[model samples]
Target chain A: MKSNLELLTIETIAEGFRNEDFKPSEVMEAFLENIKVKSELNAYIDTYEDDAVSKAAEFDKLFKEGREDLPILSGIPISLKDIFLVKDKICTCGSKMLSNYVSNYDSTVKKRLDDQGVIILGKTNMDEFAMGSSTETSYFGPTLNPWDHERVPGGSSGGSAASVAGRLAVASIGTDTGGSIRQPASFCGIVGLKPTYGRVSRYGMVAFSSSLDQAGPLTHNVRDSAILLDTLSGFDNRDTTSLKLAPTKCYEALKKNDFSPSEFKIGIPYDLLREGLDSEIDQSFNLLVAQLEKMGFKIIDVSLPSSKYAVAIYYIIAPSEASSNLSRYDGIRYGFNEESTPETLEEFYVKNRSAGFGEEVKRRIMLGTYALSSGYYDAYYLKAIKVKRMMQKDFNEAFKKVDCILTPTSPELPFKLGEKKDNPLSMYLSDILTIPANLAELPSISIPFSISSSNLPIGLQLTSNKLCEDTLLKVSSILEREVGFKSKT
Target chain B: MVEKKEVLKISKLSRLLIEENKIDSFLKNFSEIIEYINLLDQADTTEIGKDEEIVEYSFRDDSEIEKLEVEDVVKNSAKVENNFFAVTKVIDEE
Candidate 1:
């Protein structure tokens, strides 16, 4: 009596496709129908119906022709965060500024996804230019938390994480700048990884905060994230910041499991857990630690002395970088244009931007410009970078004694959608536990820990040193098994 | 509290127009955020040196990048003329 496609993981669906249990087109139809009925969730800004069907049909034909060596992601439908370019597709980056704009070239990430035969279901919504923590700043409207239908899904990757958690897409890719990906993943009770900063290329991915932005996957499980990471990561000459390290076999690395819990040391930063955290989350974290200790991991007290200043440093540095990165949106090139003819060039710039951008985007841009202004550059911007280095040094020192660090992914659970929208400071504080990873350029993952009394999902975050995703994934996968939290469709 | 004039100055510098009615409320929130981030002033960064390894220079063969088509380039513009984007006249006609 099950007319709908089964809620399956990306790995399960790929195996099903290989075995011909269900065609890709059939799965795509079911997902598209689900998205239509659940439109109230606001998880997707657009879904490619005709294109997805045709692409699925092409994959089915290839599979039928006995192409046993098909790419791992072939026919797997996924969603993009709207920041990455997909040639000829509208990439709004969740802003009115680029509402009608189409990309002429595919971003490096899109090209890699295409090469592996991954079909993009559509471009998902996000915070306008990836700015806000709740996705409330998106010009299209906020993406609701699927779990409660009234709470936020967390952002600027809210739509990306929500799409996967709601079973609208098998997996989704989102960019993280100061916990955009990990925080939303935690809120939605899905697996979200922000790979080390340069682990993925940024070419043609709409720039937010250049130094901190790294695109990663959102999935229901760590294995799917590892699968997507293996496909999405590599060196691309187009992005100068792209790392030169050899691509990892993350999926295979998950199987190694060479280390035991007895040999592992987990770091708990007392300063991060001191205050401003929900008691429910603190309880969940304590339970997780107890479970780990039962499995034999020795918990060590670690100090990230500079972490208390991370939020203050992040607000200054990210916005300062954003202000510079966003200057390319002048109407004379591409994106929203002023309707009235301006008499002066300055008037043209002001009119187009003022009309195109939302309130938060403009606010950040102004704040950034002030911070980087001539007189205050040394006091605000430069000082922030110095503190950023100290934050990184703290992590480098902590890793010496601990295999990985554990913290609450967010200070609180998924909150009501409009609760903190009006208070920008409160929205910014939501990322407190997750921002240190971005500041330190380390790989971090958020996995479900337990369920709240209010029936919402709670998450625990794990962090490892630079380029140490294998350790993070290994630890998270073990935790995922012990927790065994089920995701509701 | 920040002066009203300073808000206007930053807005102009950012090339964003703040509506007259919204400026008062906007400045209030802006001041609060500014005050919050000012907590960094308490951190003693005296021992931290300037970020020397910040930039990593990677050079490639000097070559022209493939340019986007004129049609695609001008598609989102409000006005275009003869394969060029139309913009406000920069020079004055005396």
Candidate 2:
């Protein structure tokens, strides 16, 4: 088995497959070998060794027959965050609740990826229900950051990000509710994109906060992300919210769009830069801005005054939505249930839920329930909705003036495992800058910036208007090139 | 300040049982989180008057589609009987 296939990106792997440099099964084995060697990273929940290998063989045979219908991602090995259901496979959303549960049908994401002829390695671990900032809350365990074993890979999409960064898989897909994909992508020294809401269908992707949840790409570079997003995005009747727009435009634009850096005006919301940002991150971000300016890109200061309340708005709205969505996990229908007898329906539900969920998930559920409860609903849930409108208004105003907005993907570098485990507020606050974009339903991507003095990677974030992933990927790829930052090899 | 009893109440509503030992810490964390999010109170939404809720529904013809088999629907249940979910008794035996 060749060793370099695991490190080859989706784009490079596609080129290799086109050139018949190596068989797809060889690529699958290389990734499988890497997964076995890096098992301690705990990136993968399970590896479909036989299934993935067989699928790669089928693709290889198709290649031999001179098939003209092969997509750009044909034979590329990738991983999915466990939340996206793969039919006939277990879809454990990083929670004990669905540990034994098998998916009955393919999530739209899985169906789309399957159509692309991509070889799926397996499902990756995540924060339980994609709830935590780090993968620590996963029932399987925290996915250790490959850059530094002691540190965390920022999560609920930590495993997806880590798989790409650690080269355990060629590229992966992760969901970003509130920085789940981007933050992990930043921490793992890779590119992660959270596309505009409704850009991709959510059917089969488990709901956390229904409105805030959208799936996108986690990859080694911006082009790969565009390619994956192109494959994953489209309208589906199964997902009513999925946009009825032309699909597969992102990768084409990435290949053909020629808007020079000088034509782009990137905004920096200096006001939203909280006081406690790590000084090193501040220096690196400033350097990045200077580099963009040097490249003839116009950098402007835009104000998003309401973004300061983003954390507060996200906590209330996400949890309130979560409380309702999660109610489907009643013990009678599906998910984990007690083996022992409970006399009443209420007792059965409480017994299963209390035992099924991890700490952070329960906390969010309770917080959501408290907010949406009778008297408090107006003060908490309604109030947050009003504030969310303000946040969205701010983004609307900003986007009118600038093509895109720039911010630090994370306030700090990847922290040590167990660092913020007990501090839920701090963990929630970690998402401050990222939440505003989610609130506005805009497209955002995190690109690797530079390594800190401690050798951990940091990422710079770019946000574009809703449904503007084309420009988002354009700006990101430009920055990805300008910086020329390489991940730890 | 959020009280312990309020936390318990929220847990009851959420269908989650907080253990006796974990309630103290759970309550502590819950209170702190609530306090932190209270920052939203500072944002003046006075001008943001009652935004009338508007929901736009996209209409499509209601046509028959393939549906999950009964066994497929109930396969993930902890207990399935008669091709349906089996649950604890909902009625009392007087």
Candidate 3:
């Protein structure tokens, strides 16, 4: 029963507290203990042990007193990708530069979660500054995939994904900049949502690519993603990109259960399936299509012509923005400072950044700076933006004929840690299928579909039009129930 | 292929110091990535003008508030002096 309680969903945990079956403190203890047991996975950068226990205790008191003012996610233990700022807490952003940096203010997402009374288990790990496709670039070390201990939990939201898959927490928050959340979620065999780009605020999220970065949830299943989204998303004056639109009513839409596969037009982009797709993944995907056909959804062949160039586009734009965003990390204001005095300020800047950042982070920063450099700006940054426009056009055109598009979350299964560490480009390819969704600024979710012959999990990606996360969630929940792919971790 | 001199220039421009020994490996990786991104040259974007707005952002009111205390602002600084961040001196007196 204790084990069962550890894996309970947000809804179940809330109901359990309401019924007086268990208190929020028990849930916190269970997760905290599980987190300790899974420490070797390197899934968390730090855990909020005292803060979480105290929060849970306070919530339990409210529950015991029969307070009607309790928030929806009150007492649920959730992990945060170290990228989100929690006031007075260390937000390393999985990089050594800001290893000791503490945030003075809460990110909109963190503040929202706090308001809802969600117990933060800790800050999960990720790629350094959300640059890489794998968590290997993290200064804290790579987060190992819980499913296969030898393989990586996909990143840059890898630790968040692993935490949910390992049942360390009910659900966790992760940011997706070119598929950081979804790709890792796919690798770890869990539900990861990358909400519409502006649907969630990015006020205190350390900027990777300002245009592409979005914060969303990673969970064991779909409903929790919706519940987290319902609470985490809203307008924030702090983030200019934050949507001024009304609440998406994501949780309420899930309860409606008013979905028909027959009525919704699902598009299959044959372009994604043709090249570099693993045979086993292709077979599993075909089987899924057959199941959807039997369920009455019309699968139309749609083409995202410019999607083939998505990785190239993402690499250019993300790095260019990163080069600019990370320029603020010079040694003076905050972060790692070099002890040796330099004759010039420029020397201090160069030396501090060189010593502070990891290899991959430096590579991208250089790449971005080069792309945004005078001579190459037209060839790289400008060209990538044009391609981005075309990619967005491709998705918009596809959506005209179909309600949503279906694709594999990753082209291949989760690979062994250090497999692609030496070859950075090969590592970047893992996010090929997931990158287009971010490039288009669309809502996408990765739901576990099957376990591979080697016992690794593979996920199916569903992307809907911008702000159509409700449609994406409804279809994903239906498929989640139908597939019922039990997570073995 | 990028030359070592070019790599040095780019690294200096980026304000990131690449170690002298690692320049060769950095050049190889940088060139390969550049070659990969050159595929964008094949895309015909003549119809899409630079004036075409890709994203529209909503602005917020410019109300200023005392959000962070001076202590919190300088909390993470390597050196703080009188509520101000202490940095290496940039100007030298004649």
Candidate 4:
């Protein structure tokens, strides 16, 4: 047996299980042991030990009985970010307000995964309310980067990315409101996908910004991401925003075993390279482009000028909607309520809310409220919306000339925890490259490309037009094979 | 320019009470954020439309639907009395 199961890809795990070389229960036990040993990473909020064990036992029984109804992920263990509701489990969303709140129903994604026979490993930690770029805002404390314990695992989905990188679980589900999934995935040296908004059902997901919030898989490679997306994507009557189109059978596309790099037209955004990106990242990105060119893919220089305003516009629009969506957690319904003797009903409302929310959450709510307020609405929120429309148009035009757009996921690798805590603006800049995908409602993936001189992993981002995740995965699979940076669990 | 006083006002509206000690730091940080956002005001938006069109949709009539009894609504509350949600009195007589 390997010293750590970190190097186990989904393909390898599935092959092993199919050949009867190892049982699902044994794999689950190995992950549990690794999680315990690497407890300092703080990757999980809750582990479903009995649930995982029972599921694994059921899969083992089915295997012995020669039943074949189970899907490809019949015995795979997966972690869920704290935001996605798992019935009867604590879905805290990394906030003290919902710390004791047990979900009464499984989220649509969770239900679909369960139907596929994927065992629920646990719930990973996250930033409170998915508000921060780094998981440092988590009420339970931040999840550490698996590569370098001192640096952050890129965040809101920090714990999910860290757990997968650290090999605590095979793959995890993460919610990306802005760059929550990709940014952390970049920092942790794993693959993360933010499926186009409406690509996955948001039925039981706690809303941050309904427009920007999307759920996708964080896996070890593009194939696993495609498989997870196959299980997770579909139309649900519960989420009105879910696309009415038939659910994409992404896994079938990957299973076809096609490896023609000449078929891919990789779009390179020249503007991103000339901007505020780190020099090392720029060099690594050029090296990646050189490798792809050698593989016969045409590297076309495309321009998305409006992308320069993504972070500024995202902050405004996301917060504006977040302020409205979060208004439901007024302490009386589903969150923490303060025991205060107020002189008026209004005072009761004030005191409870004042006590419940954390500093970062409060800061965002204030900024959002002011942006949407009567006098300032047109100046801030509405203006941001217009810019968002333009940004989407820019992407729509860019996709016409290329198969996929590629860029560095983060300008630089993960910094040490607490390094950017005091400077909120600088922290917001970390998601500069990723926010455009969300704004455009496009599918994007981040895969680890190289390690920095400091041994921190760097991520390369590949994005495709809406509903074209197949193309994105195909390109990513080719890159993964060429780059060959497998997890060293 | 956003001032400390303005920050306090927004805090009150948002129901976030920043302590007196931390108000200055919060104000400074907020000012910097606002300054960064203000750069967008310089963009040429002369062709942009100001008025947004609101779309209205028709829904099935609910006039014939029976309303839920007050008892049903208050049944899940931890404490309820006389078809009302019970709680500590929030207002005091002057």
Candidate 5:
């Protein structure tokens, strides 16, 4: 049995409401009860139970009045990762620096969700400043994996993925920078999509490597992901980077019956799978490739040689951007400020930041600062940017021959908590495969392919060229139908 | 190679305070990372340009500035008095 009402997919919940099988208030209460029972997961940093109920009640009234004007996501409960600002709520961004910080305005995404009548379940946990891949670096404490509490549910967007995987929330919004969403979604056995950069506005998301960050959804299935993406995507003048392309009616895209495998070509990167991948994952990925071939899709071998350097390039670029982006937190604008008087302005800036940020965040900030420093800029940061360009060029070349690239989202399965805490390199290597998509500004999705014999979740990643989210979703939906993994209760 | 002193300097540049006791461990780990990054320097980057299109512009706006009241800003802090945030003194004044 499902543990709570909030765990149901948006489609399922909407269908039930339409059938009058259960009231919207009943579903809201079920989610509140589930939150109480699953406190150990730390999936939520804060839940607006009263607000959610009121919204659900409002939706119920709309149903009673037979209002056809209701939005597509009426009464659905969606979790927001702490990084996204929800007006008047504490939007801590999972950092000690902003632990008590509350937002006075909603992010464009939040306003859109609210306008569409999606109920805000709560704010989910994340890596401190969305830096780590394992969610272990969250200031609020690591979110336990629901499948096995000892292991992490991938990170940066780990809590959002875990909440969806554990059925705590039907769907969630997570920010992806260097694989924050897809990696965690892979580890947690769910669907996570990072749309083309600028497809979603970044107006009120607390910045972390601003150029690379894009918010996407984590959901149980591809259809739900497409539905959420439809609402989430579109241009907003507030975010200069927001895309100005025509709005895609993604829900309508889902209904098209032309999902024949013969129409698609799949690309597999042989080198990426050969070196860093685990044996089980390789076997599973090959098996999925074979399954796709049997289903009538053409498979082709593709090369993206520069992608080998993506992890190194991403680490430098992301941190460099993060260093600059996070500079505003020097105790003056929105975070903790040290009270002591300093002889110089520089010393005051140093003291406030030194006291405010946590260890992992500080480490990245320093790594970033050094890369961007005067003498080293050409040697480190600038070189990474060049590599980033080549990585994107490699993808551009590869996409000329194939509709999508398929690979294991993560090379290895989830590791035990604290296993790689002492070794930052090992942790960084975990996100190697997924970072290239972010660097290329392409769209990718991670869908649970098969569960290990050990019962841990393993994910298959499907990546399409820039703004080709439709094909990615169509392919993922076909695979989801074939693989058939049940959602965890 | 990144030296121990360099790590300390980078730490200072980034506004991070490394306790004297943790310096040894920090240096050992940081040097390993720097060594790994050195691998990128050896790549045949002859074709790679110094000015690449991938470099993103900074997301700050210099055109429109919104001035705020000092009172409106400090009113939300948990510990504030005299239009300033109260905290433990961090440095000695000259």
Candidate 6:
């Protein structure tokens, strides 16, 4: 019964809450129990067992009192990536630099989840400052994949993905800068969505690559992604980048099932998959497409030509922005070694950062500083921006011909731990497929649909034009129904 | 290829200290990434506009709202005196 409760989806749990099958406190106990048993998976950096239990008990009391005005997500259990500030709780960003730093206020998403009375299980682990492709760089240590202890869960949201995949948390919220969310979700065989660039507010979330970073849900299924996105979406005066688009109705569309697959033309960039993709994933993708074709949908062969340069463009632009955004850890304000007395301010900053940051974080900071340096700025940073515009134009042209594009989320299956750690270049290629959507500021989702022969999970992705998450979710739900994938991993 | 001195210079500009022993491996990794990003030069960007993409946000009304306590703001500082952050003295006194 405890294992079964851990596997319940957001929708089912919400229904069970209304039906009085079990109280919110019971759900909390079951999940905390699973987390305790699977403690070695390292999915969580900190588990708020006492706090979560108390909150769940309070909600259960409210439920028993017959409160009718409670929110639909009031009793849902979820985990948050450590990047968001939770007001007095430590917001580490998986780096030693701010490992013990406490946030004074809540991030917008954190406030939203709390306002809805959702029980936050704990803060999950991640790459240091969300810099690396593997969770190995985290100061707290790597989060092992629950499916196979020797393999990675893909990162920097590896712990977020693992928490949901391991059933440690019913769902999780993770930030994506160049496929940080989807890549891990794919590797872990779960649903991960990176909402349109400005769809969600980033007021209190730590900045990685400001232009590319956007948070979304990693869930067990498509409907759950929609449910979480709806709660997290809206315009915020605090976040100037927040879009003024209409609030998402993804969950509503999912329940209504109002979309027909026949009305949409799905595009597959066969040329992009001609190389670099694993044979099994390539075959699985083709089979899924054929299945969609059999369901009365028209398939088109479309290519975003400039997408070939996604990695190169992303590397230049992300690091350039990151170098500037991460300039705040000067140790005078707040950070590791804030208490240290150094000979000079410069020495203080250099010393704290050198000791605090891992190799990957320093590597990025150096690369970014070099790219944005006076002489080389125009050659690298400016050129990458113009090329990013070209990539956007390519997507614009493709979207005119196709309703949405479909592709494999990752080029390969879950890799063994340390398989690509030594090779930074190859690690960057892990997000090659998921990076284009981020570059073009488009909305996309990765859906886990099949398990490979070796018992690893594989995911297929869908990308829709910006502010079209309704259609994206609708079509994905249809695909989800047709594929009938559940109990992933 | 990035040389040893260049890596040190950039690290200085970024305010990061790089010990001498790790400089070799750091330079190796940094140069490879720099080389990888050079592939951007292959794109024909002559007609492309280099103008920065501007995202226009409406100016919000300036209204007083609840604010953080001075103590909350400076609580993380190593030295706090009279509700302010105290850092290392930068100017040399005569």
Instruction: Give lDDT tens digits, candidate 5, residues A175-208.
Output: 9999999999999999999999999989889999
Among all windows of ten consecutive residues in candidate 6 chain A, which has the lowest summed lDDT? Answer: A480-489
lDDT for each residue of candidate 6 in A1-489, tens digit (9 for 90 to 100):
434777898888877777788789999999999999999999998878899999999988888887888888888899999998998899899998888789999999998888888899999999999987778889999999877889999999999999999999999999999999998998888899999999999989999998899999999989999989999999887888899766688888789876687899999987678899999998888899999999978899997778889999999888888899889987767888845678988888888888888888888888889999989989998999999999899888889998889999999899888897778988998889999999999999998888899988898899999899988988888887888467654
Cα lDDT tens digits, model 3, A217-242, are 99988998998888878787788898
For candidate 3 chain A, the 10 contiguous residues with the lowest summed lDDT are A1-10
Worst 10 residues of 5 chain A by lDDT: A1-10
Candidate 2: misplaced stretches above 4 Å? A1-3, B52-59
Q: Best-fitting candidate, measured by DockQ?
A: 3
* Native contact share for candidate 6: 0.75
How would you encode candidate 4's per-residue C-alpha lDDT over A398-486 as one tens digit per residue? Answer: 88889999999999779999999889889988899999999888999999889889888889999999899989998888888888487
Clashes of 3: 0
Candidate 5 lDDT over B1-94, as tens digits, reads: 6787778888877767887897887777677776777767755677877765743333555575445467767755656778887654656878
**Single-chain TM-score of chain A, each candidate:** 0.98, 0.98, 0.98, 0.98, 0.97, 0.98
Clashing pairs in 2: none
Can you tell me the DockQ of model 1?
0.75
lDDT of each residue in A1-489, candidate 2, tens digit only: 255877788888887777878889888888888899999999999889999989988988988887777898888889999999998899989999999888989998988888888888999999999998889999998999999999999998999999999998888989999999999999999999999988888989989998899999999888889888888887787777778877867777888857789989999999998576889999988988998999999999999999999888899999999999999888777788878798788988898998998889999999999999999989998899888888888888998889999999999889999999888898888887788888888999999989999998989999999888888888888889888487776
In the predicted model 6, the residue pairs found to clash are none
Worst 10 residues of 1 chain A by lDDT: A1-10
Q: What's the true lDDT of residue A115 in model 4?
A: 89
TM-score of each: 0.98, 0.98, 0.98, 0.94, 0.94, 0.98
Descending-DockQ candidate ranking: 3, 6, 2, 1, 5, 4
Off by over 4 Å in 4: A1-6, B50-94
| C-alpha root-mean-square deviation, each candidate | 1.4, 1.3, 1.2, 3.1, 2.9, 1.4
Residue A37 of model 1, lDDT score: 81
Q: List the residue pairs that clash in candidate 1.
A: none
